[model samples]
Target: MADKNIADKNIKVTIMPLGIEVKATRGEKLINVAYGQGLDVNALCGGKGTCGKCRARVVKGGISEYTENEKKLLSEEEMQQGYVLLCQQEATGDLTIELDGLNNGQKEFVPDKGAYAENITGNDPIVTKTFHQLTFPTVNDQISDLNRIIGDVPGKVALDLRLLSRVPVILRDGEYRVTSAIFNDTIIALEAGNTTSQLYGIAFDIGTTSVAGYLVDLHSCKVLKTAFAANKQRVHGADVISRINYTIENPNGLSEMKELVINTLDEIISKLLAGSGIPPEHIYIITLVGNTVMSHLLLGVNPLGIAFSPFVPVFAESITAAVDFLGLKTLLPAARFILLPNIAGYVGSDTVGVMLATKIYELSGNWLAVDIGTNGEVVLAAENRLLTCSTAAGPAFEGASISQGMRAEPGAIYKVAINDDVDIAVVGDQEPRGICGSGLVDAVSELVRLGVVRKNGRINSPKDCPMELPEKVRNRIKTRGNGLNTFVLVEGKNEVAITQKDISELQLAKGAIRAGVEILLDEAGIAELDGILLAGAFGSHLRPESLKGIGMLPDIDVTRIRPVGNAAGSGAIMALQSKEQLQIACDLPKRTEHIELSLHKKFQRQFVRGMSF
Candidate 1:
């Protein structure tokens, strides 16, 4: 009884910027408390104190002392400014906490458009509306209302009882004239007369780092509006394995993760509707494509199996469920939610989407398509074969796991070049706060080209730098308090730099991706001579020259490397627009061969070789 009371005892915690107050247990962690009240605290390491991303300021309360990880990760000035790691600190009393832009729901930058062959071969959408004017039934010639509506419809029509209940009212309301929304021979909705022109649908690409939504007018097969937001599941971790482990370790982790992503989709759907002045009921279907883990999480399926050896997902087949079952706020209840199929434990539907959008299966020549993100998925089409593998590239590219890394937002450095001196391009033209993924790639690419970083991923000291190297560039190399060498990008009161550990993280990421590419090439027993397609928001932003300079990509002419913007999202849009495309998406998993890099014999040696510049 005493233990129960102690566990139930609560204290107040005030979150700033929103000024929201919530009650927490007496000794609870502030990150947990904030997240419990629906606040998005940036804990990329799943509150394990490894990522050092959940840093918050304590404005009005005394908290627990820092741990060893905190001492190593936080700067001296940050500690002096009343900042503490939220995951490591316990709330000893009432507290007021302030979150930074990364945690305060700041808008993230995602590529709004992609380069896919916009030739939608067919306009036959999955859901279709047909206007019907039925003859009124009398005592002399009477027929059942359900039979009368579905008599002319082809195939075995599955009837929803709830929709059936409204049939009489709709038939009478329109005076025997009505429109029926049909999906896969299922009568999902019944509306008033001549409402076929209001048909619409939404397609979503649910990436581990971000979610992109496209609202399409099914009538004209045109995309009306698009929306993007950072994935809410990022608070748990930046990779799928971390998120899966989170679900295993916590009691309510699965449900919580599902709710977070659903919330992200809801926000995006609201934006799409508001921006286009479309009614929620007008949307008849929603199509989604994501990695296997993301697909599992969205459907409330436990992804524990996919996180371990002999990884096996509960289901890799396409799934179709109602929108209401998934807890979407602004979408209509009867709308069909379709999730495309997955190929393997790691090689998921997003890869399939990439193939669908780029039509890699039908390409005559050998081609390679790589979707760059925290979890990089690579596809190679050569010798009449399609091969794919997923690489654990980590969060280095998305600006996680680096000491001074952040998302591509305002004040983030997104581009860099080193000639006489280092020059950087910051997002929003603001001061350089930290380096993002593209900036990290650009900086390291320039360093490798200039001999500042060696082939073995070592940073040359100022004295050891080549005699021809410019002095201004050499002077930027310095050692920080952690005793690791760092290359300074912006020198100031709050200096932005990339440390030795950051380089190592990037090496591991790029090495994994390159290794995957090599393994696929070797498996096909072919030498690469064709073009490469970079597919994703991250891939769209990266420079092809920089990618090759860093040894992340193969040695190919810059013109051969092309950026297909958000091809996975484009695949989803294609599926939403045409039933033929959706069927192709469903059948892609069966056709393409998946190469499990973990079980491959040459992964370790190839990884080591690929790590070098």
Candidate 2:
């Protein structure tokens, strides 16, 4: 049975039996309306009607009529039961209808429409501590305003314009009772009447390739919301060196890049604030953690020196900047921006963020933390010595370097496991769409195990393969324009293929990481590692077994491998929460020794040797 009502305003309409209800806009197509609400009535080509898994029943209103496409996807028995294609049917009126059992599968945790602002970690450095009061202006005690404030305020307490603007109002409102937000002894924001209830902070891990942020409540040191997006500045260049070169080639290019990242951050912050139902003024501080180039870019400093000779950063110390400098206008105009210390030109804030979050500085045992991104930052600790370096691993892992490659999005193949027989268990359990970074590692490893690919990463002949290659795999070679060695992972529609060129890209990426580790160990005079801590989203999802099989990682005790999720974000949060920790972060650059692996001739030899499958 079905019921219908024509509603004038946007309303929530509950579908009978399914118990699903969503607020939809006026005149929205019913099928489209359902899809928008995440009703997973399957559409094989995602509403393109190619495989047609979205058949449903319109038991009441449209029972007498049927569309032509509906008949093609439904059987006579199904039609009698009042079946229809969910995609083809339109919601002419607010209606209730029965749902099929097949479409009623259990739901997974889909991210909500709003931003998340809870359960965050690593956000203490940027938030300010409050412990100061304002004085009233009296006619008899006519001490000049500047001198009166300066005399009472502690040493090195700097005040920015945003805080200066609100001083008079705050003084009058609080009647001299105020708690000032202090960053590194500098006044950032002032709260009247000893108000200290709602202190909020935002921690940002601005990578060269991507941006991840966490909104935190400073009072509880809890991360309230988290957001991640591709770095918009990447459209200009892929690597740090490339970006630096762009900056050097075009004088304003650096400023433009900085502006793009700031704008992107501002947008994300706005969305995050909206999601958390918090106002921008409530956020008292922002802590930014990124690579050296990224840190320099955020500060609008020229990174040309880093791109070229000597490779020196303008400053490696942690800096507390006014939010206005970065165009974060919504924050307490005087909101503080605390930047993490950088070890070197290449090893930037990201490494420091990892160090802070992992507590590598406090640990006594030999440890290695590898933050894998386009620029693979590695930190190795042994006894009293700490060494760090940046390896130019490029963007292969994120699927940027390869042709026809993409991120681990909805249809992307995120995993592949093949036995000796060469059978592939693809991710998403459907026709292969495109290969992701993790899937590439698995595919290469499985190809080696099945002898489909040779030890040197060459594609074997059809006869040499343990099992016959699929039409998809064979087509890669057949369709190659220059008679190059290419292998397709999927065929025809939504096809995914890998060419020799793609393999080379992966090879180069792996080589850089492997060489970096080896060089770091060689310099440390350490033969082996007790353990390897892999950090970052990419590193966390990477299968160690697959990585070892493909020779990306040394074949060691697998038990020693650990993935620490979002180490940079974790570190940023840690810095935001502790003033002591913030002080330690400020001194880390001075204490660290940055080793340039590219300058070493031995690094080239090691990288070449690591190219083997």
Candidate 3:
């Protein structure tokens, strides 16, 4: 441990754009300080200083000299501009820094609507409210307030001691008329007057990169509002393994991760309540679904075990607890929190949510569902069997790890079409800042189709281009400073191009996903798929033709491919609206079979074959 005198000294750091000031101990890593203060600093390599995504400019500061990683990753111009890697620098004195890239107030594109199965029926929510008009206690009939309120309620009614203490006051406040909020057999809350119509619940799909929330009316089973926000835990890393490593390396990492996600959920809840004009107390239940690691981190459980061989999680079953200690400021004191079950260490409740939303188990024909993200989860339902697997596709699809790649936000190139010349469509119709997942796929698909990029994932040199290729398109292929060929999509001051390295990254990502799909199909004895369902925000926005063109997905009729918008989130909403759906979600883990790709001998062979376009 460090000396007490040295540890006592403090340094001040002010972050720009947000103008947030924070205090840190002297000699602390700048990235740790920023993340501890709830700032979203991008650390794709988990502070190993390899990815160079956490670049920050120091307006004025006394800091440690850069490490070898920083020297290698930062350009001379950037170093001259006083830009330093937050992961590599330690604060020695007061500092003022400015963040860059997506965290710098970029507008993210979040899917607000999802496709819900038509078979889901009923409004029997897990939490319901019933108004009670009790008779006034007299000398002839002197009954206790708690007993009188739950006298006619069926089953073994249980109430918290704290809530039981307020029984008399609540009963007398409305002249013996009150509303009881029942969660199963427990009376979770009691209001002075009739609040039967105010019953509400919130469902959340907590992902590695983003969090999506839905507010639903329990009485009518209609979604009143939906909101989305970046998962604040992204400041630590982009993938589950990076986050798991953080938890292992840091003493308080698990709690910090839990707090960051809870804060994200609170922000989404605030937005949902504000948009719908709903009271916080009206939301009596909160249902959440996420991957196994995310679920472990949210509950302050150590997720290090989930990142290794013979992977084991602390708990794989559903959990129900009160939200009082969850740090959700916008929720009621009596609100209950429910976490859906996980199918495996990698195949989490999000996949279970996908299964629930698509009703894949009931489908008679062979169907494949893929939720694409940093980690791709594939599910196949066929021949009265359900199988799932996870592939580490990396953040290439989300636009990290690739040169000049970014999220699907404003100024991001999202669509590309190449004919005689390149035709690109950017998000927000603004100047292209960088390429996102869809645009990356589309661009590479077009290049492969046009013979600019070969099946082996190599970009053809300008002199070796096809004779029939247009001059404008051929001229766009140029060598960059790294001596590698790049295909320029937008030419200007902020030139957006796809380098040979970018193509390789895309190939690795798409290849892993394709390999997972193939393995699942083979395991289930599926000869052909009747339909393919793309789930999640990234998956939904991806064009079917481009996905197939790049060989990421199987070659099938385009009409059979469907985009199921945020299906995981839709399943969470289904659980929030109906108790039966919640039961189904909890039971899904048992029925589904998980295939561990790491132990599979055929994975490597399939992966190598899938890498080719």
Candidate 4:
């Protein structure tokens, strides 16, 4: 009776940008309204109001008073500035929201697109062209121009209405000699002369922090050009949960985030086309590899379901759809986007790509694969007994959470070494703007060595720090501004410092990851793994020694640790080039297992244990 009464009170709300006018229950929270409308809101806490990411500006209607959670998460200035927490605000009446973009910073990871060094087994391009000369049709031999062209081709092929429009002139202009570009079983394009040589595909890895893409020549299976850019969605929120909450909180949030990613891909795609001197029409296929949440967001599917208890995804199998379906069809109208399959809720397709790139599934002995990021995924396998889990590592590793942290771009410090004195290496050898993930690891490792920080992540008081240092180094330590004992890494205008909370963030990140690794190893009944296969752009930049110092990695032979740069992207590349490779990706989920960390009887104990060094 109560459910029926609530259903009777449904109201309609209008959303702009996406221009959605949908029926929502009266007084329903904005996140649920947005979620029901298929909008991706930045609700990291699943509308619990713990994360404070799902915020929207109420432009048309008045909202209820702010809650205590809002006061804690948002600044008073921001609240007075008109920003309202979406989770706390209810749809009392019709409302309009203005979704803001995150200011652009950091470049995307673009792998070098040179000659194709990896061996490709087969040439089975979905789009290929065939050239044929037809006999001139007189009245006696007259057949329709469509049939005439179809007869000249080797096998049965249908002519698309779009391409059919060009058939008349194409035959006459080429004097019955023409090249027909066959996409799948249909002729998509007709050329006056032999233009069958141009064939390409693009493989992409969409990460939480960045997106990387590679353009490959289908004929030769060689990388022709590559392009990347920072994911424009970062401005909305830094992590997947944040982006999810945004959709839940804002009416048009989902569509807005989807557009941002597509635009980012379009930008990178344009550059690749320009650099390769290939027409967009020539690229026949694209394979996108990302976590399940990211894949859901790209498909404009609501991921809030996966954000809460009993986490589940809308699609677990591989998806192949025409480019037109994604709104960027103009760039590669003939292309079909292939999304690799996900292993489970949090362990996504990117992990499948990791498996393929590292060949860990087929490998013997104990093997541990960790792709550390905002959400860290760890896979452990002994022979065929595979186990995997995703730990909420937070955004510390990506130069997030820390006050002065930034992406590994120009002017960002990438490395550090300390003995008698401190030494640093900056990306592009420019002035130090901020420290990135690699440098953070380096600093933490060196600080531990120099006794500036204890195993509990407590910054030493000047007296607690046993290592005697120069006056300059000693002067860098101070405490102020909601601060704990802080170590100033840089001075001047671009002042950078690491505080007690900064170390705490790192501790949480590393602990979650390490605990996940331990759980997997314990399940497999192995004391230690044979080696560590680190994937992801961040993993590539991390030093084994630094990771070990932070207790993020297991104590293993230093020589055993290997960085497989963008293995997910490589897996996408392999999928684009070979059907067998794509099949291997699809088959991975069946053989693998996903372990729920929170549900584990020992998770709490391990988590508490992991919080320390």
Scored against the true structure, residue 515 in model 2 reaches a CA lDDT of 84
Off-target runs (Cα >4 Å) in candidate 1 are 1-25, 33-40, 75-81, 98-121, 154-156, 481-484
* Superior candidate under lDDT, 1 versus 4: 1
TM-score for each prediction? 0.94, 0.74, 0.93, 0.79
Error of 2 at 55 (Å): 33
Across residues 189-284, which tens digit of lDDT does each residue of candidate 1 receive? 888788988989999999887798888899888888888877888778878888999899899999989998999899899889895778898888
C-alpha local distance difference test of each model: 0.86, 0.69, 0.86, 0.77
Which regions of candidate 4 are displaced past 4 Å? 1-122, 136-162, 182-188, 329-332, 467-475, 479-483, 492-494
Ranking by TM-score: 1, 3, 4, 2
Q: Please provide, for model 4 over 1-613, each residue's C-alpha lDDT reduced to its tens digit, 9 standing for 90 to 100.
A: 9998877677666665556677876778876676565454544344667655466665566667888888887787877776777778787765675442211112233323212225543477656778877888897987999998888777788886756667888989999888887755777677777777876789988887668888888788787776777677765667887788889989999998889788878988887888566878777778999999889888888888789878888889999877777878446454578899998779899999888878898788899999988889998888688889999998777665665576676667889887656688987787786777789888988888777888888987776677475556666778776657898787777677787877998988888988898888888888977899888888877889888877788889878998877788888888888877888889988889899997888877787777776
Question: How far is 371's C-alpha from truth in model 3 (Å)?
Answer: 0.2
Specify the poorest-scoring 10-residue window by lDDT in model 3.
105-114
**Least accurate stretch of 10 residues (summed lDDT) in model 4?**
100-109
Which residue pairs does candidate 3 place in steric collision? none
Task: Report the number of clashing residue pairs per model.
Answer: 0, 21, 0, 16
